[model samples]
Target: MKEKYPNLHRMALDYLSVPATSTAVERVFSQGRQLLHFTRNRLSGNSVRAFLCLGSWMRHDVVSPEDLIAIIRQKRKRPSE
Candidate 1:
C-alpha cells in the first residue's frame, strides 16, 4: 500500500496528525456549534479557539470560576469613552 500510494501516504501523514477525535474534541465542537448562531457567526477562528480553550481550562479547574468572574468584571470596568 505504501509503495502504491506514496503521495496519499504523505498527505495523510501531514493532515492526519491532528488531535484525536476524542470526547473532549466533540464537546468543544458542540460548544462551538452553539456559538455559531446568526449573531455570533462572524466570530474569528482565533476568538473561537480562545473561547474554547478558556472554557476547557475552567471546566478542568485549571482556572477558577471566580477568576473568570473577576476577569469579566475587569473587562466591564473599562470606560467606553
Candidate 2:
C-alpha cells in the first residue's frame, strides 16, 4: 500500500524503527549515574554527555582503546592553549 498511501507508510515505518524496549536506555542511565556519583557529581553537562557517549561506545566495543587514544591525540590542544 506504500504506493497508494505514501505518508501513512512512512509514518508506520518511522514508528516501527523506534526501540520496543527500554533496556538500552535504562542501561545508559545506570552507567551515567554511577559515573556521576560522589566526587564526580560536579561534572558539567557537556562533560557528562561526552563521557556517556564514550563510555557507551567503549562498552559496546564500537571503538577500541587504541582508537580512543588516537582520537584524543588528534584533538589535543596545542601548546598555545
Candidate 3:
C-alpha cells in the first residue's frame, strides 16, 4: 500500500509519531504550577527555569542526587567577607 500511496503512508507515519495522550505534557505543567505556587512566587525566572530543568532531569534519571551533589560541591564558592 505504501508503494501505491507514498504521501498517505508518510502522513500516517507522522500521525503515529505523535503521542496518543497529553499526560506527559500535563504532568510537566502540573509540576511547574506546583513549583510556582503562591508561597514560592518570589522565585526568580532563572531560578525557576533551573528548578524545572533539574526536576525533569531527576525524573528521567539523567542525573542522580549524588551526581548533582558532587557537581554542586565542585562549583561551590568560598564566602567573601
Candidate 4:
C-alpha cells in the first residue's frame, strides 16, 4: 500500500482512529445471535440484515431526526444505474 500510494498510506494512518480489528463488529453479531435464540422464529435473510443494521446503529450514538431525514432524501435522489 505504501508503494502504491504513499500519500494515501500516510493519510489513512492519520485519519483512521478506531480499532483495526473487527471485535466490536463481532460483538454486534453476537447480540443478533441472542435475539434469534430468544425469538426462535425462522428469519429471512432480509429481516436478519435489517435487524443487524438497526442493532448496530441503535448501539451507537443517536443520529438527529433531521440528519436521518437528510440522509433518506440524498439516498432517494441517487439513480439506480
**Global lDDT scores for all candidate models:** 0.72, 0.72, 0.73, 0.65
lDDT per residue for candidate 1 within 1-81, as digits (tens), equals 779976555545443556666885687689888877778878899998777666656555556789889999999999987
C-alpha lDDT of residue 22 in model 2: 98
Query: Could you arrange the candidates by lDDT from highest to lowest?
Result: 3, 2, 1, 4
Query: In terms of TM-score, how similar is model 2 to the real structure?
Result: 0.58
* Candidate 1: residue pairs that collide: none
My TM-score estimates for the predictions, one after another, are 0.58, 0.58, 0.56, 0.42
Per-residue alpha-carbon lDDT of model 2 for 1-81, expressed as tens digits?
989976556555543455569986688689888989988878899999788766655655655789989877888854545
Q: Rank the candidates by TM-score, best first.
A: 1, 2, 3, 4
Residue 3's lDDT within candidate 2 is 92
lDDT of 3 by residue, 1-81 (tens): 989976556555543455568996697689889999888888998998688767765665655789989988877864555
**Candidate 4 residue spans exceeding 4 A from truth:** 1-19, 61-81
The candidate 4 region of ten consecutive residues with least summed lDDT is 55-64
Once superposed on the true structure, which residue ranges of model 3 sit more than 4 Å away at CA? 1-23, 74-77
Off by over 4 Å in 1: 1-18, 21-24
RMSD of each: 11.9, 8.8, 10.9, 8.6
Residues 1-81 of candidate 4 have per-residue lDDT tens digits of: 789976455545433546568996688578778878866678987888666654444344333456767988999999988
The superposed Cα distance between candidate 2 and the true structure at residue 61, in angstroms, equals 2.7
